[model samples]
Target chain A: MSINLTILGCHSATPRANAFPTAQYLEINNRHFLIDCGEGTQRQMRKYKVGFTKINHIFISHLHGDHFYGLIGLLSTYGILSREKELHIFGPKGIKEVTLLQLKISQSHAKYPLIFHELTSKESELIFEDDKVTVRTIPLKHRVYTNGYLFTEKEKPKKLHIDNINHYEEIDRADYNNIKAGKDIVLSTGEIVPNSELTLPPKKPLSYAFCSDTCYKPDIIPIIKNADLLYHEATFLADKTDLAKKTKHATTKEAALIAKEATVNKLIIGHYSGRYKDITLFKDEAQEIFKNTKLAEPGKVFKII
Target chain B: MSINLTILGCHSATPRANAFPTAQYLEINNRHFLIDCGEGTQRQMRKYKVGFTKINHIFISHLHGDHFYGLIGLLSTYGILSREKELHIFGPKGIKEVTLLQLKISQSHAKYPLIFHELTSKESELIFEDDKVTVRTIPLKHRVYTNGYLFTEKEKPKKLHIDNINHYEEIDRADYNNIKAGKDIVLSTGEIVPNSELTLPPKKPLSYAFCSDTCYKPDIIPIIKNADLLYHEATFLADKTDLAKKTKHATTKEAALIAKEATVNKLIIGHYSGRYKDITLFKDEAQEIFKNTKLAEPGKVFKII
Candidate 1:
């Protein structure tokens, strides 16, 4: 199994000229999941070619305008496009109220089933599960009720090559089935075929944890530990740590600390303050503690191996 | 006095990628007035360089999201930018409730005074007047309670060439002021200066009528007649006349018909349907009926003559 992640936006509460607000796309086993849609997210999707129409599940982190302002517009566009499939959204308790009230006031109704799951942010639990993947909310600490998500791919079945099985000489049908089921086999015609000779081992299940928009919260370490790829909000540098605390945000050092403690394979930090013109300083600050840290720039993709 | 009109968004309820909903920038004298703020308007402003921070007055057409989705995000951004100047917003009865709910929900308390001017939208009356311009709402027909604004510039006084008068002969302050004020030119030396020789004719007061997101209503003709610039929505092609009537929208032909009936100096039609790949067809169609028709594309400015 293989999974890929795309960073849609990475700016903080304030919008900058180049950077957009918070949003990310995670593709696990061919299924696309959207996380923490911000203002202008649809435009970002179009610019990045994220294929929003195929996306069904959307996860919003919190109620901040930078987080959920684009949801209503996107929802309305989907309605105009006459989307018949049910659209699922997982967010805090107030998300439904906000969306419904806006829809009520505007006198516009959605043509699709807009299923909303308002999850409480106090606990970490599985929010969505399907045949291919499972998603769990990573409880976060912020001024508002916020939660992140972990998208983990399900284990792949033991590998089987139909051509290789057919090519095998004098192999019994039952023995071939056993070998395809990850068992060493001896044919009834006195022939033996090793499992590796017939089929290779299944690929590793990939897990992408989006600690999407949270301050420095140590409580989420247990849930997000050892994630193949982790994206966190580093809204400020260490020199402005005081400002981050005052605004209930995270500094680069704090974000790196979380990544280092959780043992995340790769740490992608973003949501930089617009005051700093050079974003490379953010990566430099984060790399001091977590050597695998990198800054999330727009139009760039990070691969998780 | 002159008023420069720019089309921010000209769509009706539907929003497309190239064509935004309903938003316009009316610059009368030196003040900027915003009418019908739609969703993604700030992004539109950024893309078109609308200079939103300089805007003081905002007039919303109705409670539709296309008319006012960008308000909350713009207001929040204004607060973050530390803008302390008071912002005046004019809209219908339900507008205050809608904006206040967004602020309260997001915990966005603007440091600036966000004054609300709730227009009854029941009749035509002067809603605002300044030293340079006067604003009146032209009641229109729509599915919801919607109104358009008539932004007319105040009359200008005669322009006196002080340098010409001083270079030609000695002129007293009293005489200069009198000539500039359109009074009989009298001098202390008993030599009356001909007003024609010293003063030039003042430019005509430029007027712009913003009529958007409204059906082709005959009631608006008298109110917007002979406006230097009139922006009417053309949400569909003439072939979709049935769909236009069913949805309470207007076709390009209908929009041109209204402009022709009102005898507006310049007619700009926009709010195109996404189904139409090219909007040049709209311009061609409208120009076939109304000679002075133009298309309202983003980043283009039209000077009121």
Candidate 2:
């Protein structure tokens, strides 16, 4: 399985002419998800051509304006579009009340089923799961209650080795299912063909970790360990460590340190503060600790093959 | 005196990639006001270079997402910028509860005083008034309790007629204030000059009427009569008259009819439905009934001189 991520918007604080706040589209194992919808995120999704109908689940990191202000507008747009699919929202406990109040006051006709999974736990826990994928929350430390998310692809069944299966005429099409199920196939001549010899192991499952709007917390490292891809918030550089600490946001070095400690395969840093004119400095600073660090830009895509 | 209006966003239903929802920046007699803040209006304000801090009053037409979803985000941004000025908001009754709930849930640190003038009156009534300008609600017919706004510049003091005053040697600079106040000039010889002869009347007060998401209602003609400029929602063309009626929206012909009957100097038709690919059709249809008609476009400026 593969994971594709599209950064719809990634900037800290208010949205400017060129700088957008935080939002991302993650497509893992054919399932589409939206993460941390800031203001103007719907427009950004339109600009980036994110499939609107495919987004059935939305994960909000926190209730901060920069993180979840776009949720209401997006839901209203969905209503205008006459979306019939049930939508699931995962966020803080107050998300349901705030969202429903707006929808009620606005008299929105979004009659579709909106299921809210309000999160109040301060520890990592599995929040979403389906046949193809599973999502877990990584509780994060921020000025407000927040949670990161981990998405993983479920293990697939073994694949039949065509060349090895053809070696014996007794290995008929009927026996292929048994070999693919990791079972030994017995031949009519009383010989046993091991499943490992007749079938190949399935491809390794991929996982993506999303952490944003949080202070430097090493406790989350173990939960996101060895993730194929990780997106961490880096709102400032090392020079502003004091400011970062005061604001409860992470610096580039802090994000890189977390990435390095977690041993994630690749790290993507975003949520750059508007005070910084050059975003490349964030990548440069993050790369000092993690060589595979990348800067998150609007419309930028990261793929794990 | 002049009235400057910038169309920030003027579309119907939902905000699209290129088409924005209803939002306008109106500057009348040096007073700045933001009218109908749709989602992404802050970004649009930055794009069009609308002075953010100058806007102390915001008027929302209705609780529709297209009308006022961006208000929360803009208020949050103002808090981030450390704005201390008290903001006045005028909208429907439930606006206060919905807006305050979102702010509270998000823990927005906007300590600035947000005064809400809830409008539940069915008849036209003045809502906001300052020294330079006055705003009134034009009760509209829509699916929801909606009210359009009428912004009128207060009449200025009379202008001194220098050429006419030059003819009289007794008209001294010390008496200029009386002349500007439309008082007759009294010379040292006790000879009285008529106020009309000593001073010229101030420029006629300019007014703008903003109507959106409404059906064809002729009763509003008296409320918007002889407006300097009128922006009326035209969500559909003549061919889709049934749809417009069903949706409680107005067609181009209906908007033009209102402008013509109201004797407005200029008419701006906007809130075009997404089905209409050629927005020029709206202008053409509107121009058929009203000659002084313009299509509302993002960043388009309309001036009443």
Candidate 3:
């Protein structure tokens, strides 16, 4: 019933002494998902105490080395650990071939089913749905084919009004299920107690959107509108706006602009360039545009409410 | 001249919290070479303070994930760092295609030239040679095509006998180079001083051999014979001899036997199975056959005499 995120690594392309590349672990509705596994992600997972076996689905934004180089090592470790649970991987086209080729050359065959779901759509589309949450792909513009993911919690059942239910002596204990399901209870006296009188409306469902390694594009605002939380990559500060545009990456101002225009409740910025040792400038610049902006540091956890 | 080896990573297969996979850095004859770059090798290099730009030649024994999964990440880091030096990579066949395919898929073109030398021969052949050192392949028995490398220091110039030079004042200082080259020196009095009397023999050229992930193959003894140091993979103890044979891995006893038969000055055993947490047992088992056996631990350095 809660959405939690753990930042395994947040630095850009190369992993250095204390800075790691991009990797995040999201836990929502009792399920865990790994997003953008860069090199040393497994070590980061271990360092953060994220359960490696709990990661069943992996979502990759693109085929960049900083995003997907750790994939083979992770898979190899799973094989070495003799993991039997099926693992689902979703990414752009050519990921499957690239993964399989590495495995073939390394002579490593995974004991678990490494199911891959290739994404190639240019528009926002639902990619996964379950009873607790729904996942959709937010097509992104980058140097390569990329995708950002939108995770939204499903509507929860109404909260039971204990005092109202206690007043209904005619309602059996077995009828509680029906009351929680938004149904009225029928009494033996032929009187109907409205469900609204016995139960209160559930809280608003929360949603989180992840966007990384993309240029400034207002087209994604509609797809991620009204999200409870949004994570965007800000590789450079405002001064490097031209460099960001040339590299097809976003600046802090651009990321904040997207978050502000989309009306997200809170925004988290990460994927800082290694050249910038101090990240306070990024947060300061981003906050100028979106006051709710936060820096995504490694091992930092955020709750989406 | 001296041959120094730094063990960057020594564990086998999967990288763990403190135990990394196989990677070793060798500084021989004023040249740096990286052997078996496993996952997190760049981080290990940083941790051990090994100069990154000094490594120009990389030798990979096989395509196993534990051996070469870190290559792409390292190459990407080099690109990000704007390294313009050409890197020479030597590995088994299919390495070039695999490396290039990953680069193509990731869209990470190296700024430096990544020249590849695909090795397919199974016989003991000279793979590389320079004025300082000569490298040859030691055919090994493994699950796939594998080769162990032998690095031998080329013969050095004889050391001038300082005291003897002072006695022969008539021998011009310019003739010192000729004396060091093992030529007889003639004084102004026409007295011939034999090369042995004028100059001492050059310190015996040192050599080191690396054999890993292979079974007990006696044929490699001749190639590694009289090596100053030999690093052989001892994946299991004597108790797991059956498993070693089945998996085509060598046991501690087998590695010791090979070292003893090859007459190596020192034997370093590594690539331990994760099951054995305490590696002292491997050293003990190896020392029973070869007295000069040593354990290869992360960050451990071995000096070859």
RMSD of each: 4.3, 1.6, 2.5
Q: Which of the two, 1 or 3, has more TM-score?
A: 3
lDDT of 3 by residue, B15-72 (tens): 5667788899999988899999988888888888888899999999999988999888
For every model in order, what is the iRMS? 2.3, 1.1, 1.4
Q: How does chain A of candidate 3 score by TM-score against the true chain A?
A: 0.96
Residue range with the least summed lDDT across 10 consecutive positions in model 1 chain A: A168-177
Candidate 2 ranges with C-alpha deviation above 4 Å: A186-190, B166-174, B186-190
Better of 1 and 3 by lDDT: 3
Give the docking tier of candidate 1. acceptable
* Candidate scoring better on DockQ of 2 and 3: 2
Residue A265's lDDT within candidate 2 is 97
Write one digit per residue (lDDT tens) for candidate 2, span A32-137: 9999999888988888888899999999999999899889999998998899999999999999999998999888957999999999999899999998899999
Which pairs clash (backbone N, Cα, C closer than 3 Å) in model 1?
A: none
The DockQ leader among the candidates is 2
Of 2 and 3, the candidate ranking higher by TM-score:
2
- DockQ, prediction 3: 0.66
Report how large a share of the reference interface contacts model 1 reproduces: 0.25
**Per-residue CA lDDT of candidate 1, range B1-305, in tens?**
67777777765544443556777887888879988877667767777777868999999887777788878888888988899899999988867776777777777878899999997748999998988888999887677778888888888788987766785556777566778887765566787767777888888777787776777787888998888888888889898989988877788899898889989888899878778888899998998889899998866789854
TM-score head-to-head 1 vs 2, winner? 2
